[model samples]
Target: MSSRISGPGLGSRSARRAAAVTPLLLAVLLSGCSSGGSGGTKASSAPSPRTESTATATAPASPDAAAYRRWGIDKPLAAPPAPPSAKLTDGLKPGAAPKVIRRVPTSDKVVFLTFDDGAEKDPEFVKMTKDLKLPFTMFLTDDIARAGTGYGYFEQLRGEGNRNSINNHTLSHPNLRTLSADAQRREICGQQDVLEKRYGGKPPLFRPPYGNYNDATLAAAGGCGVKALLLWEATMQINDMRYAQGDQLRPGDIVLAHFRGPSELKGTTMTKMVANMLRSIERQGFTVARLEDYV
Candidate 1:
């Protein structure tokens, strides 16, 4: 037989203990449910391992990565292959008018960067090149190089390495196609003398002003000790590139740009223009190689 305990005071000690413990047990269950809900929320909000791994994989990795970022490049440029022991002259003869070269003949994924006219003298460009160890060739006109502090500025750009070569552009940047042979000789040979004296050696390369050249221009360039008449497959502007052939960059293509500043670039700095050029180059899966290396 069972008896019913109706009042709190009428219950046994064990029954009273259970009666008091039941409220605490309910409180603990509620608390655990609340905590579990919060834990689920946190787990959903946290980043997954796959997301983290993807971020790590896409980040630029190189000693100069920070420098590249500073200069507006997304990644550090690929280092060029070591220069060949025997320079590739592409069947260029020693005595005749130097062979005209629009591109180096090589299978390596490389292009040459050549800058013409020392018009803009930005000190920061020197810092950028040095910071990145970029290699390029300069074809400086005498009038522009001698103007103001341009000569010293280019000297800073030449630095202490043989990677940056100073070549002849001409005395006054006249269109060689319009000039007589004697006149062309004065333009090419005269600037040759200036560059040799100022830069410490005779330049072995020459680029005709405005990409304009004739047989007389080549003959005069050879007379002035030019070994090759360098031309361009692409010209880099402030924000875009103009290609002589297709819209794409080709292996060993020579790219032309100028030492121009905001005045000529629609208010873009020379460094920014160069950074854009590099971005274009990177998009094409190519890196800059020293033009002096293969030519």
Candidate 2:
């Protein structure tokens, strides 16, 4: 949850973007959220289905990336493997220039899962992601930690495999636009230092709280070395998911969720919420892929 902590083991998860902006854009714009559930959200749009060579994963022919083969995927991705990333661009490098991105531009039927706020630290959610071998990303806020350091669960996530990327949400979940420029820097750059110290690398990505940002926000983010200001195309709740453009899933969407537990979700656990999300993804014939690999 990125909003206020309502109670122990409970926090408010917000996909509550700028109420002034449209949730779904007729075209792929720099829009930020879909709808928030107890889970995640993504951003982007397409008039029709797009093709992605990177959408499929067969038995990994290489030893380095072999973990892709063990995915406990529900059905065949039913697509061919993408060619090697010869000359593939790496959009995740620090200081790459900050641009608002609703979704990755690709033809591959791969989507990203990004959970914001470090609120509900659920051990079972960690196990579920490991068991499924699903690759996703995390946009974390420091103040929302559940226990000592509030980072143990994420450390646990990192230890399990090489499938996820950690990003900066902020020190506290505040609308950067509401604060002064230096305060904004403290919010953006301050967390950059904290996350780097804790996670061992500076976060190259960032997502403003409530999908709220302005020109000053982006400027502060870029000054603090953020490469991309991420938004979403879909949002996930406890029981189901929401879309930006239409009811159908489009290629290259980045789904958003929160690290929440039973307290915030009408007594539903994070595992159940994730299960519903996976069902939605499978129903759409899309596969979960490493967000960093294709960016």
Best by lDDT: 1
TM-score of each: 0.76, 0.72
lDDT of each: 0.65, 0.60
Where model 1 places Cα greater than 4 Å from the true spot, the runs are 1-63, 90-95
Question: Candidate 2, residue 21: CA error in Å?
Answer: 28
**What are the RMSDs of all candidates, in order?**
33.0, 10.8
State candidate 2's TM-score.
Answer: 0.72
Model 2, 275: alpha-carbon shift in Å? 0.7
Q: Specify the poorest-scoring 10-residue window by lDDT in model 1.
A: 35-44
The residue-by-residue lDDT of candidate 1 on 14-36, one tens digit each, is: 00111123344232221111100
